[model samples]
Target: MAALCGLTSMHKIWDKLFKRGEFTELDVDEEVAGFAELLRERNARRVLDLGCGAGRHILHLSKLGFGVH
Candidate 1:
């Protein structure tokens, strides 16, 4: 299973599929962990998560002390 809707370059397709909650079976903890590490390295205090459907990433970012919008 693809972490975030496979390796498809076209994000719109994945966005549509994800928004409908079609790909909930995939595990993305590793990806999230890597992203959190990157944010910490960059000292990311704020984030603008556009197209943040379901607010999964947003929630994680919030927990990491990022002011997500």
Candidate 2:
């Protein structure tokens, strides 16, 4: 389908950008910090990052003591 092809093209573009070190900033956004707080409040110890391009959130969450994958 055209939609599927478009998605694949987008994926390739993102992969290239990631390889070039784009979107690799480690600074966690305020919203993510707030979400981390909520997770902590709930006693959540782990996070699954399904599309963790450049692993920014994974690293941030790990530093905050959550196991990130």
- Every model: Cα RMSD to truth: 8.9, 2.6
| Cα lDDT of model 1 by residue, 1-69, tens digit | 575555565578778988888856434478887998898998888989886465677777787789988
Model 2 is weakest, by summed lDDT over 10 consecutive residues, at 51-60
Overall local distance difference test of candidate 1 = 0.76
- CA lDDT scores, all candidates in order: 0.76, 0.88
Q: Which candidate gets the maximum lDDT versus the true structure?
A: 2
11-63: candidate 2 lDDT, tens digit per residue: 89998988997887778889889999999999999999987466777788899
Q: TM-score: which candidate is best?
A: 2
Any runs in candidate 2 off by more than 4 Å, and if so which? 1-12
Clashes of 1: 0
